[model samples]
Target: MKFALVDDIKTEAVKGAKGICPSCGSEMIARCGNFKINHWAHKGRRKCDPWWENETIWHRSWKNNYPIEWQEISLLDEKTGEKHIADIQANDGLVIEFQHSYINPEERFSREKFYKKMVWVVDGTRLKKDYPRFMKGKSDFITTNKPGIFKVDFPDECFPYAWLESSVPVVFDFGKLFESISGISNPMYCLFPKHENYYALIAEINRKTFIKTTLNGEWLSRTEEFLKQSKKTKLNRTFIQPIENTIRRKPSKYVLERGKWKKRRRF
Candidate 1:
């Protein structure tokens, strides 16, 4: 797919606008630009650092192929002065965020202060490598073929998107995420915007057993319990390790049998 921003914001305006900075509500915001990417910048040093670095990374990776629509936002909580500008818009009035680096715990808690439905997408693989590098044998992290999608309903008190700022790594196993949504027939498929095929499989799995198989490229074995077990968690979430010695096989064609030459001679 061709990548470009879906919003009306032009390439030039995407860098900076006169509007107040979403993080601090400062009117000193300005636009910055480069050949490949563009985003807002503060005119002077401000309190909250813009998440431009994080946004740049994702833009470089998928911007040319999958442009994201960035909406200007400045959400505030009446109780605290904390604020957040979500990364993207979810189909059903939900907010979506893509985080790459570690975030402050306080910052995390404040993100979901106002929203009812919010989704946070972080680099699960990076988290695994940072924390659980040495302790491999204990939990036995079973890597699935695809990155798992998780839909965790937050406790009313806890901010749902707050986990994005947790210093501890958050992990997700692809198999586990699929299993969670398998039971619900025709569950909403907006959680993972990157994986379109998964949405179709999820619908099929919910309707009948053994109908839809595999995601990305990994073939799934038939087991309802196993499907349920796959999930993205705060522990060992990462892409599944590829099996090195797996023998590659090709499909074979059947051939018709021929009678011995002796029968033809007798005739």
Candidate 2:
């Protein structure tokens, strides 16, 4: 949604600029409103892509972090002949989607399948109750052997359940606007889904760093660095350690109630 084709070249939205949609080749007009961020819209107010969502400041902020070439890339599936524009398709085929709105589980699964290697950057502060629910769910978190990596025993009760069973990794932006922070130091939490539990990897570097590492296949090395750094204060029982110790000693259990998990009462 950020870029349209002007004079057969990808162009950013500017006031009074007329262009064409790169995806559907439809006529587009630049919308530079006082209240909303400037963007391109189909001339007839029609949607070319059914999967497209209304762009927000949150989405634009994330897209601006990457290079212009990498933003709004059109990907085609040779096998299925399906085409879609990725929010960001890194140099190494890693698709990063910045999601601010709610989506059903089916669509989430379909997107994950289409993009074999991808990561989701969700806006966790979208709803008023999101942060409070996540805070409550944190009580059931357990740290993993990998520093900054934690396991949530019951993920269904968490804030973003749409991606709970996502095959790819997911990073949550707790509405911590990344305006002033450098790309490499943007703090985020990565979630990796397993059979019944979800592993949460705390961001050591900024969002940019994580993306670079993942693109270069250096994520394992990054995890190692965090593990070694975590040991220096192992004795002091810092933030990650205590949870790791607690889970190591006695893992908590939950019961399914009305499609959600309820922490079992301990005697």
lDDT of every model, 2 decimals: 0.34, 0.69
Q: State the lDDT of candidate 1 residue by residue for 149-168, as single tens digits.
A: 33221111112133423322
Instruction: List the candidates' TM-scores in order.
Output: 0.39, 0.76
> Which numbered prediction scores highest in TM-score against the true structure?
2
Error at 253, model 1, angstroms: 55
TM-score of 1: 0.39
Error of 1 at 129 (Å): 2.6
Cα lDDT tens digits, model 2, 30-86, are 999889899999998798776789899989987887788888888889989899889
Model 2 RMSD in angstroms = 6.6
Flag clash pairs in model 2.
184-206, 186-206
Clashes of each: 17, 2
Candidate 1, which segments miss by more than 4 Å at Cα? 1-37, 47-54, 59-72, 78-83, 125-128, 131-267
